[model samples]
Target: MKTSMAKQKKSKSLLRREWVKSMVQNRYLYLLMLPAIIYLVMISYRAMYGILLAFKDYNPKLGIMGSEWIGLKHFKNMFTDPYFRHVLLNTILISFGRIIFTFPFAIIIAIAFNELKQRHLKKTLQTIYTFPHFLSWVIVSGVIFNFLDYTGPVNSMVAAFGGERKVFLGDKKLITPILYITDIWKESGWKSIIYLAAITGINSELYEAAELDGAGRWGKIWHVTLPCIRGTILVMLTMRVGQVLNAGFDQIFNMSNTVVQSTIDILDTYVYRITFQQTPDFSYSTAVGLFKSVIGFTMVILVNKLSKKMEGTGILD
Candidate 1:
């Protein structure tokens, strides 16, 4: 025991010395990271104080700390409200829809990009595909409107093709598909970037070995490339599970109209509506937001457990 204690103390001392030396040597690197660190502390960490408002009956006059404690009244009300179930259902459906459709599409795109023989062609396609991700949702919505509006190009095309013009944008049945397809268009290309980078990190020797073993391109991708990048894919999926409640405020805000509101309204839009458009029930909104966050946190834990059971590798681990 004495010897083990002495060894532990020596190891800790060495760690402290190395930490000091690394800090002195990497001062410039730390300087580059300072702004991001400050923003996280100020904007993200500091804003966590508002979560307490979920448990309180907030009053602008009484302020945050001065408000009366209401326990789980807001949370109970949120769950019992008439539209709560529909909103919850919408959030779940949209979240899983993106995962099921968009996730595999990204992998396919990454593989397609990697298979390109011409350097110039690959670079051009990459840029073209990734450009839409940078455009704000508002801009993307306008572009969609041009295509899907009653008298828009799509409707004009239908008219020319001897079909009746349709209300594509306002159709309840079409709203979910439109949202999914447009999001896939804007994000799938960018999402593939990480997978592409993971593929790049794989050693060339594996491909060469697979080739020697008579594995074709698709065979190599299935047997070697995919196995190597499974870790990244698993991590991304686990993170995605945590965000099941967060069905993109910007896109939903821009795309939703009264006609499809019942089908498309989610936790985020519900929070926004109750906070600003309605009575500005700060407490209720905060409760709804908190409920979403708590579920998100729980989701990460559950997914991590499921991943470990299925893959023998938990994302958190």
Candidate 2:
């Protein structure tokens, strides 16, 4: 036991020495990382202390640390709330809807861009497709309202064609589809940039070898392009899974109205409403936020495990 203890201490000392040596050798690289490390420490890690509010009866007179402990009272109330259940279901539905409909468009667009032979046309199309991503949700919501309003050009065209004009935004059945469509339009092209980059990094020799084997464009893409970028796709998918509960707060908040409130009320908006629109309940809101974070984290872990099982690689790995 004495000899083992001495060896362990020696190993630790050696490790410390090696770490100091490496840090000194990479001083410039560490300097470049200092700002990011500081930001994470200050903005991200420091803010984690507020998570305690979920377990406290937060009072204005007493700050977070001084708040009275209420140990799971808010969590119990949250679990029992019928409205919360509805909101959670809505959040899950919307999140999965995006995964099903919006996720693949980026990959498809990236592949399509890769297949394009005309450089000028590709650049122009890419610019047009990606331009929407820069626009704030407020602007996009306003444009959507203008286009879909009863007296707008879309309705006029419907009237011209002898079809009855409809309230697209206010209709519950239409609202979710509209959200999916608009989300795809606004974000897919920008998301495609990462996939395009992955495609660009694929070895050229693999394609040449594929062609030598008499493989066509579609064949090369199937066997070479996709397989080469599978790891990147899995990594992005794992990250997206981590945000499964988000459900696009900015877009929904901007586009939502009283008529469509029940259909589109998600967790973030519910927290906002309870905290700001209604009587302030900081502890309850914090509990809801904590719940969301837990679920998102769980989803990320599950997806990462599945990714590793299927692809022999994972985001965590």
Candidate 3:
């Protein structure tokens, strides 16, 4: 009994010491972080109460809290609605396609840029490549429209070859592909920055050692360079999974017309159309939005957990 008491006393003392140390080291940092913590709690976490509207027959005068609750009504409507099903499928397909295609291209750009021996040319190329990313999708849509118009440069080229000018924007078969390719082109170069930073952080000594072992360019890339940056790639993939539902809202909103709306309508645009145009069912739109957010949150958690289980590190850490 005496020995047990002594062990308990020792544990209490260790806890006290740790508490004191934590107080000294982290007290100021905690104070500094307080404002941001509170701001997030207020703006992000607090706004979650509006989710209650998802269950309500919300009215502007009644407000969210005063609204009449009808649980699962909106959710049932969503599943049964054929248009919602199509948009949901399109959203998932487009988002996943972008994640798979864009990540590899970013890594390839980083690796290729890393090997450039000429400083001026490399910098120039980097600047040029990144330029398109800053252009708004509205601008991009205008550019595409001009190029694909009947009398535009692309159509003119086709005409010179004795081929007919095609209306690309109105073509349902080509709309989704056009969106994906344009997104890749506009964003891939800018996205390479993170991967390039990871590549540059790799130890130069490893490259030297590989060269001494007669490892050629491809050998160094496959064995040394890629392995060093695998952690960054995994983290990127995890973050991308979290953004799987948020596939380029501005791009789709600006580019979509009545002609191809059915093919490219994502969850976000669908919500917008339902709330503002077709029917002013704010509660129903909120319910659909809430569903998308829940799915995205689940995807992030699952992906992060699987990543940790496989490699022992995740994006959160």
TM-score per candidate, chains pooled: 0.83, 0.85, 0.85
State the lDDT of candidate 1 residue by residue for 117-187, as single tens digits.
Answer: 99999999999999999999999999998888888898999999999999877899988988899999999
Better of 1 and 3 by TM-score: 3
What does the lDDT come to for candidate 1?
Answer: 0.90
Global lDDT for candidate 2?
0.94
Which regions of candidate 2 are displaced past 4 Å? 1-41, 203-224
TM-score of 2: 0.85
Q: List runs of model 3 lying over 4 Å from the truth.
A: 1-42
**Per-residue lDDT of 204-312 in model 3, one digit per residue for the tens?**
9999999999999999999999999998888888788788899778999998899998888999999899889996998999999999999989988888897898679
Q: What is the lDDT of residue 98 in candidate 2?
A: 94
By TM-score: ranked, best first: 2, 3, 1
Q: Candidate 1 at residue 228, lDDT?
A: 93
Candidate that beats the other on lDDT, 2 or 3, i.e. the better one: 2
lDDT of 2 by residue, 1-317 (tens): 99999999999999999999999999999999999999999999888879999999999899999999999999899889999999999999999999999999999999999999999999999999999999999999999999999999999999999999999999999999999999999999999999999999998999999999999989999999999988888888878877899999999999999999889999999999899998999989999999999998898889888888877877787
Ranking by lDDT: 2, 1, 3
Please list all clashing residue pairs in model 1, or write none if there are none: none
Clashes of each: 0, 0, 0
